[model samples]
Target chain A: MKFSVVVFPGSNCDDDAFQAVRSGLGQPVSFVWHGSEDLENADAVILPGGFSYGDYLRTGAIARFSPVMSAVKRFAAGGGLVLGICNGFQILLETGLLPGAMLCNSNLRFICRPVHLRVENASLPFTRSTRVGQVLTIPIAHAEGNYFADERTLAELQRQGRIVFRYCALGGEVTPETNPNGSIDSIAGIANEEGNVIGMMPHPERASDARLGSTDGLYIFRSLLDWFEQMRNAECGVRSQAAVPHSALRTPHSK
Target chain B: MKAKVFVALKRTVLDPQGKTILAALRDLGYADVADVRQGKFFEIGLSDGLGAEQARQQIERIARDVLTNPVIEEFSYQVEP
Candidate 1:
């Protein structure tokens, strides 16, 4: 599957995502500039981590207005899979594609370290390879990684099993001490209601290779590939001319 | 005309920066300091073509839609003639 990583002006991790998909996953990938409207017929879109627009106004307040974001929003509305990591996640929230917002870490410091993440719901396309309660050692680097949502939104996300990942201890335990950045309920990642759009504070691309000290992040990309393969197989059996197998085109949601 | 907008974190959300500033003030001998809440300020200049009401409406929309994140923040703005 072809993955398009959006490159904003201040984005620093666009190359990391490109390399992760190209060298790490052996998949075709390309960079989509923020000013460009075309996605190059990408099957999936990735908003990589970085301080876009210098994190001015807010983390993603300005980046959300990028010209490419309009295409991303349309792509997402059509149920195309979109993954936002770190600052990308913030942009997703700002775009209202995902619920909630992010805030400065409770400690008010820029933290860059590998942290443990527990798979809260593993049935989604983003986490199908990860088993429920499985611990993933992914690194997160940001000052405004703290996640926040209104009471109703939090309850809804919890009820719908949309909370895909949560910060936890190595033993797969959720505790205050395990919570990095003091994110509400230690939310490390979450998916939209349709499960096609996902945003996470952890930098999965950074940990996708063994040379970087961990390959646990590969599970996410592998899961996407796995889902894409299934959809392609399903599409071939149904219609031969489908360019992109969207969520609506599929029989049932990947969950 | 210029619009002065102030955006502040909602009371329900914790402001770590404000808390740190409060602590710093207390440590610096401002014993009477009770609380602190951090926010953002933006001064937007309006084009001369806009009338008074149009400018107010435009500024209000800008402040709400662009300046502040409604989920964790609230904003107030004033336009000066």
Candidate 2:
């Protein structure tokens, strides 16, 4: 599957995402400018991390109003796969594709270090390859990664299993100390109800390569590929069945 | 017309900066201070041709939707005619 890495004006992680997909994973990938309205035949779009628009008027607020966001919204509405990492996650929240908003870290400091994330839901396309309750070490770098939602929204998310990952210790135990940010319920990543769109503060692209000290993040990308392949195979099966006349089909017992 | 908008975190939300400031204040021997909250202020100058009432409504809309995030923040505005 082809992947498009969006490069906003201040997107610093665009190159990292591109390299991870192109070199690390050996997938077809390209960089799409934030001003471009078209996704350029990309099956999956990655909104890489960065302080877009200098994080002015709030992180992701101004970036959401950019021309490319309209196209991204359209793409998402069409059931296209979209992954927003870090600042990209903030943009997704601002775009209303994801619920909740980011607040300042509880410590009021920019945290940049590897943290453990437990796979909360393994049935979604983003985490299907991961085992539930598995701990993956991924690096998070942000000052406003604290996630918050209203009680109703939080209940809905929990009930729907939209939460894809949670901050946890090495033993897969979720605790306040493991939560680098004061995110409600230690939420580190979440997906939309349909699970096609996912937003996470931790940088999976940064951890995809073994040289980066961890290869656990590669499972997420691998899972997407596996899901897409299954979809394609299912579609092909339906088409092939339609090609044959009903009369030509015979019951296996009769044959 | 000129307007001032105040944006602040919702009451239910935790404000780390506000808590840090409160701690600092207490450390400075201001023991009587009960609490502290941090917020943002914006002074907007409108040059639209609308009348005072119309401008006030427009500024309110802007402050509610643009100057603040409804999910995490609350905003109040005062207009000067």
Candidate 3:
């Protein structure tokens, strides 16, 4: 499947995401400039990490107004898969494609390190390859990755199984110390109610290769591929059945 | 027309920067200061030809939609002719 990675003016990790998808995963991918209004024929879109618009005003406040974002919003509304990482996650929240907002790290410091993420909901397209309660080591780098939502919103997210990943200890224990960003309930990643859009503060692309220290992040990309295959198979099944003529079936001539 | 927009974190949300500032103030011997919360202030100049009510509504919309994120922050605005 073809993938498109968005490149905002201040996007620094665009190359990393491109390399991960194009080289590491052997997928057809292209870069889409933030100024461009079209996403071409990409099946999925990736908003890579970076301080878009120099993180002025807010981390993603300005980047959300970029010309490409309107197209991204439309792509997401059409049920196309969209993944946002780090600053991209911030942009998703700013665009209202996802709920909640990011706050300064509770410690008021930038955190950059490998953290353990528990797969809270493995049924989503992004984590379907992993098992629930599985732990993956992913690197998180950001100053405002602390996710916040009101009580009602948080409750709704939890009830809907939208919380896809959560910070946890290496042994799968959830604790305050394991949460690097002081995010509420240690939430590291979440998917929309429809499970078509996902946003996470951790950089899965940064950990896609074993040479990068760990390859656990590869599961996320692989899961996407698996989901695509499933969808295609389902579509083909419907099409083949529809191609059978009703008159031929009555004569028992249809195979 | 000119407008001043004030953006502040919601009361329920934790303000790490404001907490740090409050601690610094207490450490500097400002014992009487009960609390401190930090916020953002923006000065916007609008073009002429708008009525008072219209200007007020415009500023309110800007403050609510652009100047502040409703998820974790609240905003207020004042317009001047």
- CA lDDT, every model vs. true structure: 0.91, 0.88, 0.89
Which regions of candidate 2 fall more than 4 Å away from where they truly are?
Answer: A238-255
The CAPRI classification for model 1 reads as high
Where's the lowest-lDDT run of ten residues in candidate 1 chain A? Answer: A246-255
* Model 3 lDDT tens row, A31-123: 888988888677889999999999988889998999999999999999999999999999999999999999999999999999999999999
Clashes of 2: 0
What is candidate 2's lDDT per residue for A161-247, written digit by digit as tens?
999999999999999988999999999999998899999999999998889999888988989877877777697775232321112
- Which stretches in model 3 have alpha-carbon errors above 4 Å? A238-255
Candidates 1 and 3 compared by lDDT, better number:
1
Q: Per-prediction DockQ scores?
A: 0.92, 0.74, 0.79
Best by lDDT: 1
lDDT of 2 at A168: 97
Task: Judge the docking of candidate 2 as incorrect, acceptable, medium or high.
Answer: medium
lDDT, candidate 2, B1-81, per-residue tens: 788999999999998999999999999999999888899999999885668898888988898778889999998888887
Worst 10 residues of 3 chain A by lDDT: A246-255
- Order of the predicted models by DockQ, top scorer first: 1, 3, 2
Give candidate 3's TM-score. Answer: 0.93
